[model samples]
Target: MRVQEIPIREIRRPLYRQNDQNKVKALMESIQEIGLQEPIDVLEVDGQYYGFSGCHRYEACTRLGHETIRCNVRRAPRAVLKMHLA
Candidate 1:
């Protein structure tokens, strides 16, 4: 496993729409003030990243003009991917 500062444009979320704008704004403020306490979860396939969680954080980072983000990468069984859908 490795941690790297990835570009915001390279990150992708399976979900098409985003909700909770206010909450996301709040999180953005918090992150701006105190930095990202928790790294976002992601899965990489064929050199592409898919967000498993932290959709709001991703948006916040983008809004804050963050060039990169902290991400955790690991190898998981295919079942984990299915479970993410549920």
Candidate 2:
């Protein structure tokens, strides 16, 4: 799979609830300085990709005006992962 630009709105996990603003900010800064070292994990369902992790990274990329992200796609039954996320 290749890295592609996906809309920020498509990011499924919420970034603000982690209560690690300072750390998140620092990580974002680092990502901006050195670029994303790790691609976020995501799963495709019904033709759309939903993030399973890296919510902070997603937010950081959005703030940095990134239109797309490098993602590691995992193919699985949505019901199983949805339960995991829930």
| Top TM-score prediction, candidate number | 1
> In order, what lDDT does every prediction score?
0.81, 0.73
lDDT of 1 by residue, 1-86 (tens): 77877887888777676658997899899998999988888877657777878888888888899998999876566666667767
Candidate 1 clashes between residue pairs 3 or more apart in a chain or in different chains:
none
Per-residue alpha-carbon lDDT of candidate 2 for residues 1-86, written as tens digits (9 for 90 to 100): 55555666775662335636776788789988999888888776666677757877877887778887878766667695667677
Lowest summed lDDT window (length 10), candidate 2 = 11-20
Candidate 2's TM-score: 0.74
Worst 10 residues of 1 by lDDT: 73-82
Candidate 2: residue 6 Cα off by (Å): 3.4
